[model samples]
Target: MGCEAPATVGKLVAVNTSGSYLWEVPLETEKPSGGFGCAPAAIPAAIYGTPAVEVEEGLVYVGSYNGKIYAINSSSGALRWVYPREGNLQPVVGGAVVALGRVYIGSSSGTLYALDAVTGDKEWEFQTGDKIWSTST
Candidate 1:
């Protein structure tokens, strides 16, 4: 499962059905930046929703409040890839869906993204007028 706390970094935690910890992967941490005059000046990247697990591929997909989606190795707890290339921030409040060899997720920036499951390369994006905070169905 994925877990995170406010003002702290996110984590991909693996636990058995009995609730024993197996392993964990730490996510990227962001420093506080000047808000647009209303929001908090500083913000930390965090996981705010559930993760999508592809057991057959041994991968887990999760979105972060920091505007990133990650693919993590289930067995080794290693990071596979992150979406949006780099140096871009698009807070994702929704859970991700892995299907048809793609990862689908929405962002607070009001965009729905389709990314390559293996390389995290963006395949397509659709923009909305408002933030996309709902999970993909």
Candidate 2:
């Protein structure tokens, strides 16, 4: 994956087992700047881990360091949906997993989220005492 600071643009690259580039999917647009009255602006979204692929569904799930999860079409490299449906400031350092028709991912905020695989709807969320930066088994 290619990621640059201050820019939300990142690429989810697919490589064949033979070390060949298969395809690449672009991430979200440039991140907006916002914070408390005088607090510093938050960092842009960036990919920091591997993506989870659901071969049966032809979908790939990836999380950004800026706290957004994306669902992309495996064959077309097109974006399907993004979690939170609005904001992009939650740092999701962990990878996502797909199972039972849902996508599971965690964030630096210590929240584990379960989203509908097809609709990107929030099914439920669990808060933890610390950040979850690893893939949920």
Best-fitting candidate, scored by lDDT = 1
lDDT of each: 0.76, 0.75
Stretches of candidate 2 exceeding 4 Å from the true structure: 1-9, 29-44
The best candidate by TM-score is 1
Q: Residue 1 of candidate 1: its Cα lDDT?
A: 41
Runs of candidate 1 with Cα error greater than 4 angstroms are 1-10, 32-43
Kindly list the per-residue Cα lDDT of model 2 for residues 1-137, writing each as its tens digit: 43334322456677678977777876664663432111144344556667889998899988986567889888888789988888763677768888999999988778899999987899999998887868888
**Each prediction's RMSD to truth:** 4.6, 5.5
TM-score of structure candidate 1: 0.82
Looking at candidate 2, the ten consecutive residues that score lowest on lDDT are 32-41
lDDT of 2: 0.75
Deviation in angstroms for 24 in model 2?
A: 2.2
Pairs with backbone N, CA or C atoms under 3 Å apart (clashes), candidate 2: 66-90, 67-90, 67-91, 67-92
